[model samples]
Target: MEKSIIIGLDIGTTSVKAVAFSRGGRVIGEQEIAYPLSTPFPGWAEQDPLEIEAATITVIRNLIQLPTIDEKNILAIGLSTAMHSLICMAENGEPLSPSITWADGRASLQANRLRVEHNHIYDLTGTPIHPMSPLVKLIWMKENNYLPYQQASYFVSIKEFILYRWFGCQSVDYAVASATGLLDLHHLKWNKEALELAGVSEAQLFKPVSPTEVLVDLDKTIADQIGLPVHIPFVIGSSDGPLANIGLGAINPGEVAITIGTSGAIRQIVTEPKSDSLQQTFCYGITESLSLIGGPTNNGGIVLQWLKETLDIKETYEELISVAEKAEPGAEGLLFLPYLNGERAPIWNANVRASLFGLSLRHKKEHIVRAGLEGVIYSVFHVGQALERLAGKPTTLLASGGFGRSPLWLQITADVFNQEVQVPISHQSSAWGAAWMALFAIGEVTDLASIKQAIPMQENYMPNPDHHKIYMDLFKLYQELSHTTHSIYMK
Candidate 1:
């Protein structure tokens, strides 16, 4: 008899990935389809929804066509999508505008005004009042009278758009809706006040559902396009951040999940919905009874990528990291504030740019590279500090994403946080989490906790007290520099 398999489809910012896993949580096959981002104007990041849908179809089709996998034994496909993308849809179900990605800052002015006028929004919705949010994006559209916004019959996220295409019905999972700055975290419904503020109505939004909700009987056309059975169950998984916690087995209190790819976030699962009093962190509902709170940083490995390109470093990323490893902690008094893409969490300012402080003739290329790495880690550490206030100081660090693949970066992160970091053996944490959710939805898995026991753990990194001491001092300096120069960047 053939083994049953589950597929996880991750619709990310840069690509669409499909991972097939056995019922026992082992990966069987995987495929990824990369797509390009469009920037027609400065600070405006967009992607063609049609292109993304095509890539999604390609990935799913590729996964189903793998010779090693038996299509008959495939049980379900679960979804995990990047949050905060908005798209305007016409009455006929076609997108009227490009999908505005989370990185887009075209609504900065509106977001600034909302931040001042509607400061209570963060508490109500558990999403920061930032231009990246769909609430702010809608406000911008209403103010600017964008052509698509004027003629659209509805507003939806990229995930909803894709689901509508495949399922012929629009729906958003709880976690995705919570990131929109429009959902009431406590009530688990669209906040009327937020709707009025954004000049939108609840009718324009998709119905919110739980992550484990299953959608069966795929649209015949979509099924034929993907070469899959129409009756395969499609589980609507939660957003990447919350699902990543499940992927890394960080569902318990005092266990934090840190994912650093192009961007980074530090998140933990909590029992109830709660937001930071200072609005330094975002709290989104993962399920009716559980919430995921964390801070996201716009700067992460991207800063390192920018440094390598700017310095014309021809070596591989591994080689660059090796060179950076040569530099001692603190990078000889040179500090870098990694706000290359502005920032989120703690300081949710989009106007700020990257800054290098305490630079002198003493600093060399290796020192600069090392400082850059330290800067990103420091930014995450800053957010972690804020998180510690709420989550009670994470006892375990479950690390994932591109940065987790590097031993040097892992050690630096562990040392900076003064906590032991555990990396998962499977790098596709989000996808696996989605797959596990599908298993639960289909009753193949007994409960969510079983996922934790099934996932394989990799190497563990322990903190060095000596390095932690140095980082503590440098972090203080970093904070001082950020506060003192905060006003300068706004100009």
Candidate 2:
């Protein structure tokens, strides 16, 4: 008898990954393939959907062929993808345009206009008014008469496009659709008002389905190529942000999940749908009854990467973090506003650029680096503050992402948030969440709560009282600087 395995396919911005996991919550095999994000013009971030589709197929094939895995024993495959990727397609499944990623800012002007004129849209959709939303992107396309937009037979997300290519259906999960700024969060359907605003109709959009929806009978040729049975179940998992909460076992009330991969977010699951009044957070659906309300930051480990490359520093991430640790908790009064790639949540401004304030002769290279790192944490903390106002304080902070590999970073997060931070043994939260969704869909898992017991945990980081005090004091100054500088960035 062979061990049963579940596969989770994650379609990310810069890469596609497939991880095979056993029913007992252990990784069996994994494969990853990287792709490039193209910048044809300033503020325009796009990717070739064909390349991503090919990369996804290749990763799945590679994972199934791993020596430790037998394709026949694979019980199911679940999908988890980045949110807010828009692709225009022809009727024959050919892409009419490159996939516009969430990072794309070509729609900034449209977003700004809507944000000022139709602020109520954010209240209804639960998505912030920003260029990242496909709603704004559609407005840009309509106004500019983008060739692809005019010729498109359908407008779909990258995940929906993949599903159409594989299963011959055009469907999108609730979570992914909700992030598009076009879904009615309260009713769990397309918003008529949003369609009118975007100048499109419900006919042009994919049918929204539940995340647990299962599809069978894969394409015969592709199934044979990937060595999977034609009838294997494929679970339509939720987007990465909500799924990361499940992967980290943060489902219980008041358990906040903080992830800092290329980007960062602070999310908590709620029993009911709720949007922020101040528009400081977004409310995306996970299930019919459960929604995720949180703030996402455009800056995270990517900020550190930018610092390393721009400074031309040859040090490894570990070494760089070590240098950052040399500076005190507050970085000796130096402040950094990390809006290098614009910002989301807390600010929701795409025009804003990065800034280093309070820089003086006293600050050195180490201080600058430390401020950068601390700045990222402070920004995330700012989001947490907004979350606290709406959802109450988090009982536990479950940290997952590239930053978790650094103990100093983990400690900083704990101190800055003034709470205990728990790291999962597995950093692949989204993939693991997708695998768990597959298991649940196929009756391999009895309940969602069972995942908490199966997932292994690491030691918790407790905040240092002295450091927390310092961060609290400095946070006031950070807030003041943030508020005062908002106008300057708008200009």
In candidate 1, list every pair of residues with a backbone clash.
Answer: none
Q: Write the per-residue lDDT of candidate 2 for residues 1-491, one digit (tens) a residue.
A: 75488888889888998988877668888899999999999999999999998888789989988899888888889999999999999888899999999999999889888988999998889999999999999999999999999999899999988888889877889999999999999988999999999988899998888888899989998787676788989999989998889889899889999999888999999999989889999999888888999999999988889889977889998888888877888889889988899899898988787889889998877888899888899999999999999999999899987888889889999999989999987788888899998888878888676889877788889999999999888889888877766667777
Model 2 spans with C-alpha error above 4 angstroms: none
Residues 296-411, model 1: lDDT tens digits: 99998889889899999999988999888888988998899999988887788887788898989888898999999999999998999899998788888999888988998999
Question: Alpha carbon lDDT of residue 85, candidate 1?
Answer: 93
Model 2 clash count equals: 0
Which ranges of candidate 1 are over 4 A from the true structure?
none
Q: By summed lDDT, which 10 consecutive residues of candidate 2 come out lowest? A: 482-491
